[model samples]
Target: MIQVKQLTKRFGQTVAVKNVSFSVEKGQILGFLGPNGAGKTTTMRILTCYIPADEGSASIAGLDVFENSLEVREKIGYLPENAPLYPDMGVIDYLNFIAEMREITGLERKKRLREMIDICGLEKALSKQIGQLSKGYRQRVGLAQTLIHHPDVLILDEPTTGLDPNQIMEIRQLIKEVGKEKTVILCSHILPEVEVTCQRVIIINEGEIVASGTPEELTNKALGGQTIFIKIKGPKGEIDSKLNNLPGLVSFRKSSEEGHNFYRYEIKGDGHREHCEDLFRMAVDNNWILSELRMEGASLEDVFRQLTAKEK
Candidate 1:
């Protein structure tokens, strides 16, 4: 449970975040996206109370982030892009220190420590000094410290950085599981990970929110029309004629011509099944060999680009 209203922040002459407002419901995993210098981290820092906003207000779990900064920190597990860690401390010792700092003690502290080790896959590196660990291990340690307190909210920025593919998937699944009971704000440059891990998305650009919605909703909205690719073996003139007359076919263009009368075409239409069905039936009726018929839809990456790309 979080809410922000007209939040604004500035550094020197540049505004890092401008009149931005959004909310995340309890148990919801939100993907916070943006290109470099687009204010994603700025927003998260404000929400986490790491810095004060120049204007506007924000609250988490019903407590004002500014007024109750300490309490808010207690309720949130924040893994910043560059994790603050002590390289001299062993993984287990550093985690213990964090547990104590979080006020967890005795049996509960031990329980949390073991849970973090297992959940973060730090069992092998328990005795290793943090500096001796690889970057991936260091990331795991950062995640462990963040979750050691079982906070109600998680603000993770690039939580999977330096992790191998297997480690990435493991962390991804762990985030999904944690989101079932905690509010999560995942900020990352990896679009596919966000597409699958986040239930909703908010894209910020030039310090303002450019788009916000479910992944599918954003993609569908970005798509002005359906794109279909088809390859057919037939007389080029006859095929073009039939395609032109097909109902709901917004437009078609021959992309290339292969040998033996086969041609590839790019079709744009309203994208209803009827249009595709009509094309299939047309090919069958004309006895034209339909070698390929596939549809392409806008992806999260496409939507991100469409919304955030700058003009020269």
Candidate 2:
């Protein structure tokens, strides 16, 4: 339950976010995506009350962020881009400190400490000092600190950054599991990770809101049409010419991979999945041997690039 309306943040003359607006529904994982210097972290900071916006308003669970920051803090768990961690504090000790800061009761302090230890997989590192742990374990320690209070919303800025591939996968799985119960806004530069973790996405660029929707919706709208791929065991030059001359076809890409011909034809066929026959007929007319064919929807990456570039 998070809402940001016309949210604008600026550092003097340099604007970090401009007229950015979006909403996150309860128990939903929203992927906040952008390239570097795209203001993703700045937006997250505004939502978490780490910084104030130049204009507009933001709310968490209906509590106004600017006016009721304390209450909002009580309801959110923020893991910043680079979480501040004491190098010498023991893992459990750091969590204990955060628990006290969150004003957890004596019983909750103990109970939540146990849960954080288990949920974040910090037991083995509990007695170890934070600086001595590996990057992955340190990340888990950061997660433990954030979850110490059992907040309702999680604002994670690149939760898997800097971790090895295995560690990144582990943390991604953990985020998905957490999202099943808590509203999550996952901000990351890794596209595949976001696609796997969030069903909805918001793309921002140049301090403005570029696109927002489900992955499928974004792909469909960005393509502004439809796409299909076809493969034929034929003379490459002839196949290329046939596709290039085809009408209603937006574009075509021909390739030969591992001795097999491949072609991706962009078209505005209006949901007519029967175009495979058209490609087949063209192949027959050219006396090209038929090998394999497939039709695919536009990809999320393609949509993201299209929308962001268009806005630029």
Predictions: Cα RMSD each: 2.5, 4.3
Clashes of 1: 0
Q: What is the alpha-carbon lDDT of model 2 when measured against the actual structure?
A: 0.81
The estimated TM-scores of all candidates read: 0.89, 0.82
lDDT of 2 by residue, 166-285 (tens): 999888888888888899999887877887789799999888878888876776666645666665676667767777777656666554354655443334443334667788888788
Candidate 2, backbone clash total: 0
In candidate 1, stretches whose alpha carbon ends up further than 4 angstroms from where it belongs are 223-225, 233-250, 259-261, 269-278, 281-287
Of the candidates shown, which would achieve the greatest lDDT relative to the real structure? 1
Error of 2 at 32 (Å): 0.8
Model 2 steric clash pairs: none
lDDT of 1: 0.91
By summed lDDT, the worst window of 10 consecutive residues in model 1 runs over 269-278
